[model samples]
Target: MPQLILSPWFFILVVSWVIFLTIIPSKVMNFYFNNEPETASTHKPKTHAWDWTWH
Candidate 1:
């Protein structure tokens, strides 16, 4: 138990989890909130019925 807690691997695992919990959520939220909303102007034009005919 004491040896397991004192091991370098355990320390690394603890640090990695701390970074993951602390950094990942903020990054995800920033991307979610700061992302641009899609607009009509950016939409592709609708294809006409005849547009699919071989030219």
Candidate 2:
């Protein structure tokens, strides 16, 4: 197993990467929530009509 040396810059890079990764999911979830509500109404008929309890 190869061990990489830890340094100040390496810690900074790791922290930056972690922050970047977190931001991506946040933006994706934001976009998802923003778009889903608009499209959700269209699907409601299909989803609701299929269920007997709804009628």
Candidate 3:
């Protein structure tokens, strides 16, 4: 294996992909499925404003 293959960023990318594929689907599906029956949604959306300092 190449030295770059063992880097922290690579590990983070792989871990993120694994979690995205294995875990995120069920959670997202459950959210939509649980909300399907409701005429009024119980979940509230948060207002997110970007800080110029981060940019």
Local accuracy by lDDT, each model: 0.80, 0.69, 0.81
Candidate 3 runs further than 4 Å off: 1-6, 32-55
Pairs with backbone N, CA or C atoms under 3 Å apart (clashes), candidate 1:
none
* lDDT comparing candidate 3 with the true structure: 0.81
Cα error of candidate 3 at position 22, Å: 1.0
lDDT of 3 by residue, 1-55 (tens): 5666668888898999999999999888766444456487898999998789955
Backbone clash tally (model 1): 0
The runs of at least 3 residues in candidate 2 whose Cα sits more than 4 Å from the true structure, single-residue gaps closed, are: 1-6, 31-55
RMSD of 1: 6.0
lDDT of 1 by residue, 1-55 (tens): 7665667987898999999999988888766555578766876888866565665
Between candidates 2 and 3, which one is better according to lDDT? 3
Runs with alpha carbons beyond 4 Å of true place in candidate 1: 1-6, 33-55
Name the top lDDT candidate.
Answer: 3
Name the better of 1 and 2 by TM-score.
1
- Report the lDDT of model 1 for residue 3: 65
Candidate numbers sorted by lDDT from highest down: 3, 1, 2
Q: Worst lDDT window (10 residues) for model 1?
A: 31-40
Model 3 lDDT at residue 9: 81
